[model samples]
Target chain A: MEQVYKRTKGIRDDMVSGFCPGCMHGTVFKLIGEVLEELDILEKTVTVQGVGCCGLAMEYVTYDCTTSPHGRACAVATGVKRTNPDRLVYTYQGDGDLASIGLAETMSAANRGENFTVIFVNNGIYGMTGGQMAPTTLIGMKATTAPAGRDPKVHGYPMHMCEILNQLTAPCYLERTSCNTPANVRKTKKAIKKAFQNQLDGKGFSMVEIVTSCPTNWGLDPMASLDFLEEKMLKEFPLGVIRDKSREEEAV
Target chain B: MARKFMKGCEAIAEAAVRSGCRFFAGYPITPQNEIPEYFARRLPEVGGVFVQGESEVASINMVYGAAQTGTRAMTSSSSCGISLKSEGISFCASARIPMVYCNVQRGGPGIGAIQPAQQDYFQATRASGNGGFRMLVFAPATVQEAVDMTYEAFDYAQRDRNPVLILADGVLGTIMEPVELPPMRPEEEVKALKEALSDWTLTGHRAEEKALILPGGWAGQEDRCRRNANMYETWGKDVQVEEYETEDAEVILTAYGICGRIARSAVRLLRKEGMKAGLIRPKTVSPYPYESFDRLNYGKVKAILSVEMSIPAQMVQDVELAVKDRCRIRTCLRSGGEIMSREDVLKAARELV
Candidate 1:
């Protein structure tokens, strides 16, 4: 059997093993690397990593990488894309980075039709800064910020970014997926690849929101975390293509 | 390449495109919105990028990020918008990022009025942002100058690896005049710039080399501070100014931006009347043509009249400081979006004489 381990380009060698076991950032990072390599875009791509657990994503991606202030990755990526239209640009943001502090930036960038891909990870909590409840954290679910299972009466319901982005006519593609199982991971990878390809085709904004699991934050073992993602998280954040402007058969 | 009648703001936008700017991010503000509109239509045609940002703050940061990738990028806004961009401007200055900013002057401390005013002179020339960092400020009086200086701003920014400001007034932005556009630099030249500045730009690592990490934090940060100061010193050496009819004149009129044009008209009237008044316009506000005052023959010049369109006058202080006891000084100003008329400047100069 062939060995499966490999390091992504542009990642800092020392910080490669920092992700918590079964955190899913590492898996998503690997998936992104594979997509970039397969699409022949690794050399021409620049990734703007947002602050959060994903901010440390610079450690796992070998392409050109820069980190933005918390929740400012969309704005930064807009700059990078506008500056060098020939270069493929993308931003990896977490739930907290996208739905909370960066909501304005994310929505405005979408409205402006900036031609860049955004990979948003909806892990239901702010994993890096401790298990704080994120904007996408499901109502009735417990986390540091919401100790008593998130009460909708006090804290709003989970934000569905895919549905929100789908409402914007500027976005050429928008999808939601999960990475709890092998088949779901394959679907998530396809969604990410399509997002990149849309940019290469000069299509406007594209995004993939991956419903990932934070086992350490959820207080669940790796397998239980996967089960929680599929059983609980998927119900709140349904998995499907919310918008696909690129598909010829799809109706406006 | 061709001559066209264009507003100063429109001409500035055209010049930016001709100078090989591939990215433009700005929010719509009165007087300068023509610039972003021009880019909205032109940039996409060139396969470039144009974004109308959420705010001036976001727009400037977008320029900052784009410039870090070694591309020609710019943003334009009015006085209030510029105030919001101060933080990003300082960051760009500290990072030595090459970007162009266009400030079409307007009145007031807060959304004073959309009409042309020179009240931002102090903000543009001094402490526009936090830190002791200085920007190369170009004060364009004519629509033609507005367009030409915009191209020059980009060149100066790339050459100095710092932010450059094209400081024109609302009159310059809104008023129209004929301008002969210059030929654009080739794309290859801009790409070559990437190679030339690769040492500093935050591009990817070269083969077999450790990735260049820009030093962060307080450790040895003083050295970076010193480097920024050194850059300002070097730029000061190349200050630009325009002088007219100083020979055998008893009074000198010091002005910039639209006021400079008014001063010129006033000087013509004063010269026709044989009152012996001349004009000195500081084209670059930051380096401020300090030497021009040195060149003035104090023996012939009796006093100096500083003219501008602002209250609690700003540029006058610089003029007084520059001349400092060499000659008596008085200021003629119009606050509340009022322009200093030619007659007003003439009356002030006559009184000083």
Candidate 2:
């Protein structure tokens, strides 16, 4: 039997093999493209990718893509969405890009309830510039920036973005999902689809924070990275729907 | 067809509306707050969008977003606010997004004062941010000119695919003058003009043809820089200035924007005192109206006094470069938000004469 899978309409043919072996970013990107393709809104979608390893996301996914300065993806997306309200706009940001430098832009955009979607990729460490200590880096995680492990006294604790972003009343959808196992990966895809669907329904400011694995940055092979995410990362950052306005009666 | 007495800020807002601008995003600042306030009240009546952005940075970014969709969009602020807006301005310039920005200038190296000053001349005409890009800078002298130029700014920005600046000062922003509103252009004509530029705009792509791709980052870095520089060079050809009795005058008063208005008043007073003083008011500061000064008798003109509201910071260098050893030059200015009065300028001219 043939494997039932196909690339999204805007996915570049040449960028097919650039992803590291078993990288969750590739899976998440493909899932986002699939969601857009399913909704038939890929043609009018503009994705603003944040600065980090995920910053280069525009190169792979082929819809009208724009890259903003580190942590400013949401602000740029706000501009795109407000100007072209007819078009669907979204931002894809990593932990460092969203939780650190871009926290202000993200928070403000969410608070304003800008009509856009944000796909937040929360890997434990900063994967782009040699595995630095990210705001989402869990306690005792051994990465390049925190070789002695993350210290709450010095660097603070791992940030729960889904939990934090959920507290705000503006966002229509806020969920935390994982990509460490096949079942969880399916659940992550469902959450990603739901976020995009919220934008389609004209619900404002949806975000799906996917707890993904960074094998290269985690100093592990593909399987070990998945194991790390399942055993440690998920334990530190729990997986659940933190906020879903679509489930509320008032949202309807 | 309606004639009304209006402040410079109000005129700018009215002109923008008359020109079919439907999107305005701005943060309130002294002198220029009137522009935003006017738009906030007026825009909704005409089915336009007016957003009071979180900050000047957010406002400009909002304009950038709106302009990308091929809508006529604008933002207005003062010196400190404009300083916050430079990054978005540079982005719009690089992206070739058409938008209007009104800088109601105030005194400042920082937040110097909220009163009138022309200290932002260099900032407006020169590189406002980190890039080799030039915005179409129009220095409006009177409240009437501020209104007219603001309407013209939208046309110029779309025609040249660049950002346009209406460089007014606090005096012009606050002062009142009679302004005859121009006849409104048909919306279809404005839409046609925007559609004509669709070859380069992000207005969705046709099937089987590649979309007009804009570089997002330093993806093709050097090539992008060269392309932006060439666009600046091509657009710089339309620099303009107004020459007043410059032919036989012995001294030239070189000023621009609101400074030019004050200098004109002072020039009249100097003429009454029997001195052959003339005024050279640059309308386009970025292109600097270099050719206008080239026609003057540089050797015969005793000196060129560069009068401004800043510490003679901007026009001084331009005057020095233009007259270069052909004549003596002096700078008279009143900074820190203080408007240099006609009496003060005449006093300075009398001493020099």
Winning model by TM-score: 2
The docking category that best describes candidate 1 is acceptable
Candidate 2 C-alpha lDDT tens digits along B205-292: 5323323334345367678778768777875477778899889888888889877888998888888888989999998887788777
Per-residue alpha-carbon lDDT of candidate 1 for residues A144-176, written as tens digits (9 for 90 to 100): 878898998899788888888878878888899
TM-scores of the candidates in the order shown: 0.83, 0.94
Question: How much is the lDDT of residue A152 in candidate 1?
Answer: 88
The runs of at least 3 residues in candidate 2 whose Cα sits more than 4 Å from the true structure, single-residue gaps closed, are A1-3, A142-149, A250-252, B197-200, B206-219
Locate the minimum summed-lDDT window of 10 residues in model 1 chain B: B209-218
Clashing pairs in 2: none
Taking candidate 1, what TM-score does its chain B reach relative to the real chain B?
0.95
Tell me how far the alpha carbon of residue B139 in candidate 1 is from the true structure, in angstroms, after superposition: 0.8
Tell me each candidate's RMSD, in Å, in order: 4.3, 2.4
Error of 2 at B161 (Å): 2.1
Clashing residue pairs in candidate 1 (N, C-alpha, C atoms within 3 angstroms): A9-A62, A10-A62
